[model samples]
Target: MTAVSTEIPQRRELVTELPGPRSRELAERRSAAVAAGVGSVMPVYVARAGGGIVEDVDGNRLIDLGSGIAVTSVGSAAPRVVEGVRQQVGESTHTCFMVTPYEGYVDVCEKLAEVTPGDHAKKSALFNSGAEAVENAVKIARYATGRQAVVAVDHAYHGRTNLTMALTAKAMPYKKGFGPFASDVYRVPTSYPFRDPEGMTGEQAAQRAILAADKAIGADQIAAVIIEPIQGEGGFIVPAPGFLSALAAWCKDNGIVFIADEVQSGFCRTGAWFASDHEDVVPDLVTTAKGIAGGLPLAAVTGRAELMDAVHGGGLGGTYGGNPVACAAALGAIETMEAEDLAGRAREIETIIGDRLRELQATNPAIGDVRGRGAMMAVEVVKPGTKEPDAELTAAAAKRCHEQGVIALTCGTYGNVLRLLPPLVISDDLLREGLDVLADALSPKG
Candidate 1:
């Protein structure tokens, strides 16, 4: 129901080769000014973006499939967000919530309480990024529960900061030589239906995860059990049904906080207000960012009022945790979501994407899996007729996409999953064209 703004032409128009002269110049400048570790999938610098297309410095208008890693679900430069930010910036950019405080922060927290899963009383703490929100959620859990051990799932990605790095599962890139990470963080297996032994049921997968955690680290000692309802960086791995409910029940029984890291799957991107809504799983705490504030940086951790209140006064918050501009943008973003019924739009997009990808799977043996919900969908690339990951092919296919003016992103621990996260306001024609271009990139001739 969210309307695509008419200001942006909802079509793909390529006027130059990918990474033309202007982009090449910017890349050269970036190499000298930016850190080598700061990597980007597509180095073509964005000059403008709206609807489903991003115009690069080289004037290459490519179909946007990655919504700035899912931050612009309301669309980049969403009218409400732009105007809200403009007004807030004029009034005051930062009063530092800890110092003078502000109404914007309170308003955002109220919206979060109203929208996040469950009908119980809730409280929230704001932060500048998803990582900060996660870090603080962990802090709140440990402080409230008086437990030190944290349990995260296999293939989980929390964040890059030292504490979150410990919670994270990947070694290369995110972990590498960064450790020795913080202590008492445990990793347990989760239901990844695509890779699990054949015919495993949701109940069975949940029990396996439960047993893994109980045996490795006594659940009584755990402060929190955090997971992504639909794992994002881990290839959009949707856990089997009942998996989340089982975890929630176990946490409640053990006095352990259940946290859902909804950084990528939240804010109506997953055909629901939150992915947890799909499973009727009410998390004790939910960490959100990404699409929460259109393109402005804002994140929050909303949890049960009792647990949040358990923390000492001034236990949470940072200088720019809830910058007025970001808060204003979040307000406008939430208003847009509710007014437009974006959850419905996400479901509509899911049908189109799922059907098209399934059709591709019918012919392309390299497509091992097509999974995910709503706008948060992805396809796994495997060796022809085999489940073994074909990361090389995935990389090559993505390169092919880039050369042809399509912004396709490749993710997954195995580096073989092609993720699609188009803006919610993207036109149906634009989505079809993006899919067609993707089909061409994956075609045998390509």
Candidate 2:
């Protein structure tokens, strides 16, 4: 198989309209065949993607700012990932790790142990998606601690499964109709500096959450405290300094397993191997996905060997978990990250995007806040002179970006935050152009 090229021209060029003719046709077909439950942010139908551009069927090349929701951090069609998957496909697709294991799977686990935030001997179990990895983390925590209750924070989004829905705080689309969620899940306050009481330090916020958890579900009864180091779907909310470390210390004192949901923030997406590394906070368990396997589906839960090995031999794993192809892709992706120094690249991205957004915030009252680390930056939109969310304005800005051939995504519990997750491989020129589009989109119109 020929290697997928990473040499696509690093520029955005729109021909015809936004959706164009071919994409519109595909949209019609999708409306009929695809389930209505699945949603899409842009109308364009992609034909090929590389570096920073996603080419559509109608021959329009759009600048990719969303990175497929932070999944393609190593860049779409990364050379190493393409080569690895090509070779793996020729050899074998699946023997089912549960049935007949492969070296690729073992190699991925070893890599996970090395990169995850901790020096302790660690082991890992692979899964198919972020939600699956999170679910398995909770299982391991509960089993090891002999406890039942799990604690989640406000605005947190774990996943879509019944159990994860219970963990997620959003109710509209993710949890509204889906009732009767998994039991033993509790919610607490999180340190959102933008909305917190004026001058509330991270330690104070941690204490408030601790008090709430203690009052609601005694710490001794809690199995695990799972959180996204820098929440992904929850508007890229980065907690105040010292918040995570305080929580980790509290969990240690309480015998509760601390799981960092780095599904979105891992694999150098946040200027570091893991966001937890920024604060020197080591979680008992770390769940990873998104950028783990390039564009392929692969997730993992890596943690202390003792905690991971607590379960029975066959207790962990799924039929397609750690499929050889995905494992190969992960190895290749990790290799690319290390060889390319994507972590440093992410920090550079943070400098570029963060400076631009902060400048925008200075003049635009609608931009309530500019926050997040590395390439996972966001702008929270709000009514001028007030903290109240402005979902309408957020939607309008995102729509404008789409019409201008830029892919942007919106998130947050209130749906009023515009998030940017560009691939680490994106060119400086493309990044600036995409930012220019966003700036124009957010600008007030007559």
Candidate 3:
């Protein structure tokens, strides 16, 4: 047996079947204990994971393309992260960063300030989930700008809280029964190039959204305008080139705090530290969580110091906002990102996946569009020669890929978009293998 350390295991092994019998029994028990609303794409229970691979309880080893929904960018069981967590846990688990501050928490904040995009003086506040980070960004914006109304893009996925749910555009499961959402939240059109009128430029789409915001809410009353550089659950939708910068300029001119919800696209998932880098549109505030801590639960809102400090003392934070162990994990994750050049790796994956996806689009007439930035990408499914969504076929393709041992996710308002967010550290060969599986799954017969 290999000695455990803060490093990747030297070997990849799968000894049991996928979701071995034991895992199935445990899953049944879990289903009984939890609400049915919480879903699982693959029922295989994880026994252990290292690098870009996850070993199921049943002994089947599978490449992890999901990265725990983009949370484990450095790869599962990263050595530094594991070591840091071990040390932190051995010292102390929780004191609530608010009650008694610790070095790990402070260190994370320091790192966030130094690394987050803008050259301006920045500050950061930690949270446990992307939703909390987003909610806190809104709170800070409202507090800073002294405005009540907030604007968000169509098909944005903010969070589950009342205010965030209001910011979010999807209704089916997120907003379905959760009635009485927060008010003063308005939705504006996003620069969805695939669906835009032919010949429309990115600037045109931004103007359309700005016009809607101006007329509907009056840019003056809007405290903040939040958008994901690349819409995540809304289907890895990458906006046009000039769209984000135009919107950012508008927000700046109107004194509205611009927020980039990089929850799913940050931490080098899209070839850069943040997807915002793709457009060089620095926002007043940036929310991040998914890949920040190498699978440990950690999220943050980094922004201009003045705005972040606008909140009164004790106005922000949580019991487990910046847990010491999580902070340690974040430190390790950041180090791995810088040292191993995972950002470059993400770009490489993009080239490989992009080329393959374009080829698939050419072969599969049902694929209406293939779009995304860096490793964060998607293929939109539609009826051949028409825009009608083919969610059924999308679901089937995902199921087939799963049967072939590849885990992929489907998104989009109509659930017709297949998104790819494999860990940045995923080997090119493994990634290509997964894409081959996807291609076969998409074929007329598999």
Candidate 4:
């Protein structure tokens, strides 16, 4: 068992409105100094957080249903994580892993090897964000296989970096004006069952994509096919059974590396430890970040030793890739997950949230589709029977929930999907309360 030292910290109380006077003052200051491109989910400025709740500077308490965009899987301000960060900050902060190796960084990598999927000899390299991990994954795949081309799926969100933007599908916000991007990144159809051609199964969609990749990029020239098992931003679309497995098999047969961008789906966001496990498919390389360190800025690319080692010495690294604080936090987060059985909790949330949303779909025709694995669930909002997306309604519902004290987020290529990412540690009572709030927000007014 990974040892963890946890000391619960004191929780703060909220006394004012969400963006209380102080927070409003700060937001005004931020508007002038911060970049205009940067956006915030909520106007509330966070003062303190513990367990599953966040206290705003205005003294308003909120149930963190989004987990800071799925980063705080273990919980916000988890005792073990906080304590680890506290201890590590005093010892040292940054000594670039590439320049001066650190034990915490190495230890985190060792932990990643043991926990990240496959039993085969594995290696891991850390990065600062999910985008860096993905960009490096492409580098490793291309270097190892000597291929120039890469394939990604539609509605997939890899990251914001140049190479990642080329891999990402949406253009308006992410890719617009950010080109000319890295060369040889290609896109294919995604296995979106709800929107798939009438009778096509998930496997059929995968096959079609494979055929498209073969024709457009040629299997021999493709270095890797990176995808999210469950598309996070593209409406939480979970591909049908056999889709991932079939694709993995095809990649193996063609000597193409299959990379799973599990930045959002791994670490028990799904019912299983990794979303890929749901299909019994082992990817050649897995890139993860969001929840790996329970809110710390840490990410990793874990892969087969051979593929990772192919990169020459001094090829993969960053100045802040594995800051000791982040590494310590990761060790603490992993320990918290194991001891608390957070993976099992994720499954439990899926059953509860999925059932509740299914019931909502039956009554609310606006809910065109409800799909996802484990706690990463979402409902597609539409205009009754047709697929005419109701992005406006989605925004209205989200605003209603926020006003009613439950923080929720909307996603999708069309921006019509409402995603729920409550902390795995949230109590059953609190979960029910948050869901009730959501129902009220989406309920038809008489």
Candidate 5:
């Protein structure tokens, strides 16, 4: 999208067997050097990546449908991001925004204000990850509203930190051993149209959640109601239309801050600047990370000026919160998204994924659902004749794809959904080929 064609060929090419000799050696080294707690879905050491291809140490060219978990929407080596970061690092890498204020930090915040929904005057504070942003957002909400409780929806994935782990839904991998989490964090039901009862409308789903939240944590005690408009890491579930707006309205009337965790759904990945734009919902605060800075480690909590400014001076400063290099990368990433209108490209991706996935669904009953927006589509793999999850089948299919040099990622509370997050700049030929490979992987003889 930014005249940033990949140096590597944009195709899945298997030069050797899966986990080729070089990759196998690297895995062995990693096993020795890295902590066992860190898990990697694919162990092939990447040599370079750009556009839609990742070339590994084995020279195996893998078509990246996952986009490094949706962090490289503008391509891994987007020209703007690289150039911006290179210039910033040459000048100065880290002065620490709090110690010596720099313009890059303010520039990134300005870009956030311009892109995020709402014309209202907004301010932002930068952080290092989505979890940090969420933690800080909660802190601000509590300080501003004088409340202590935070409500999040089921199947949500806020982060891996102590506070975020409590906010997340899945427990096995994220919150299993970590106990004695932060207090006053509540979980409420959310709309999952595919799994909800028959004939339930958006308003009904909203009411059910609202009532549940009230019963669990009184509205007066609630500091914020946080949710992912398009629930990422929770099956890529797109909630029923009007469900978000209804919840936002409820938050407004109850004086609770509405927080949209747009970590994976923001920055033009969902056919809009943010998924909330699809519903025209203006969240009181938005948490963004993944795609915001291309591939840099950057995140932000942007919201109305009054709420953002409520925190005491020195209450939110961090050592590396808004590193100048990361801020520059964010600006460059934002520039590329704006100049190319990646949101429009995302819509094109949706059409491709929707048409192919739906066609496959019509023939293969195992795909119980194909739902998502733009390049963020996914299929809930289930038993052939029912809605029961088939995590075994899903994992097998992913392994088969990985074996054939196609990089795909699986997610969901049940680990049964295969999520596709190809870069918005991917060529049509590559996307089609990638889908064809996936279709083959799902077949019996593939």
Candidate 6:
């Protein structure tokens, strides 16, 4: 197969209505064949995606601000990723990493250790999704520390699997009806600056959470304290300054493994290799996915060698855990990140998008908060005069943006956050245009 063009025009152009006839037909077919549980942010069917635009089957090109929920950070069909996938497909797709390993898998693991935070000697185990990585990280923590209790924080989102559902805090879509979740999982308060009492410092908030965990689940019994340094689905919540470090310190002092779920915040998404680097905090185990393979199915748990090796041989191996093709794609993705300095690009995105969103907040009282790091940013919508979440307004704004040839996503526990995860490779012009579309969507008339 030929490589996808990286030169696809970097502008949004509507050739037809959103979800035009072709997309409508595809939607009908999808409804019939696909499971009802599967959800989509938009009904438009993508025909080609590259750079900052997702071209639908109806020939309408929409500026992508979601980046497939923070995947494709190097842009959909990044040239290097395409090349790597193509080469790997021609050679071998799978040999079962457990049965017969390839150099690609090891190479990806080595890259993970190098990119993830901390200077300690690290080892890695590959998986197929963020949820799998998280589950494995928890398993490693339990095995290494010989503790059964796990602590997840409020407004957290880990994944949808049984164990992850127990860890995830939200219930509506992610956890509802998913019953009999894994045992010994506990929830604690997190340092949510926006919702926390005014003037409460990060240290205080951290102490509050620590006390809750200690009181509820004794420190000796806790295997791990997992968190998203910047919560993803719970809103692009960047915890108060000292929150993460304090938590890491507490975990260290108490023999609880600190696992940072960087699935959405790692790989230069937060202008760094990992969000933990922002505070100079080091996690004992870090779960990474989303941007890891540049749109391929790949995930990993990278951590201290001693902890990782605690799992005996044959304890952690899946049929397709480290598929050779996906591993190759990850190698290419890492190469692109390094060659293009995408971390620096993410910082640039922060400066550009952050300034614009703050300006919008100044004029729009409904925008209760503007927070996030680097390319991962969001605006929490609320009532005009109060902090009451406005999920209706958030949904309406998202609908308007979708209709106007811009892809925007809504998140947050209350469903009131308009998140923007634009591809780091997006051009300055496209970024501003997408933001303009968002502003228009949130306008009074809209």
Q: In model 5, which regions exceed 4 Å deviation?
A: 1-4
- Tens digits of per-residue lDDT, candidate 4, 270-300, equal 8677898888889999999999998999999
- Cα-based lDDT at residue 286, candidate 4: 97
lDDT of 6 at 108: 94
Judging by TM-score, tell me the better candidate of 3 and 6. 6
lDDT (tens digit, per residue) of candidate 2 on 356-375: 99999998889999999989
lDDT of 3 by residue, 1-446 (tens): 11223233323344555556977898989988989888889888877876667777776777667888898888888888888999999999999888888999889999998878889999999999999999999999999999989999998999898888998999987999998999999999998888889988889999999999999989889999999999988888889899999999999999999999999999889989999988998989999998999999999999999999999998998899999999999999999888888888888888999999999888888889999877788899998889889999999999987776688889999999988888777777678888888888877786
- Candidate 6 lDDT tens digits, 43-141: 999999998899999999999999999999998999889999999999998989888889999999899888888889999999999999999999999
Give one clash count per candidate, in the order shown.
0, 0, 7, 3, 0, 0
What do the candidate models score in CA lDDT, each in turn? 0.91, 0.94, 0.87, 0.87, 0.92, 0.93
TM-score of 2: 0.98
User: Which residue runs of candidate 4 sit more than 4 Å off their true CA positions?
Assistant: 1-18
* lDDT at 416, model 4: 94
Estimate TM-scores for all models. Answer: 0.98, 0.98, 0.96, 0.96, 0.99, 0.98
Error of 5 at 11 (Å): 2.3
Per-residue lDDT for 1-446 in model 5, tens only?
32445577777788888788998998999889999999999878898999989999889999889999999999998988999999999999898888899999999888889989999999999999999999999999999999999999999999999999999999979999899899899999899998999888888999999999999888888999999999999899999987999999999999999999999999999999999999999999999999999899999999999999999999996999989999989999899998899999999999998999999998888899999999999999999889999999899989888887889999999999999999989888888888998988776666
For candidate 3, the per-residue lDDT at 139 reads: 95
Error of 2 at 357 (Å): 0.8
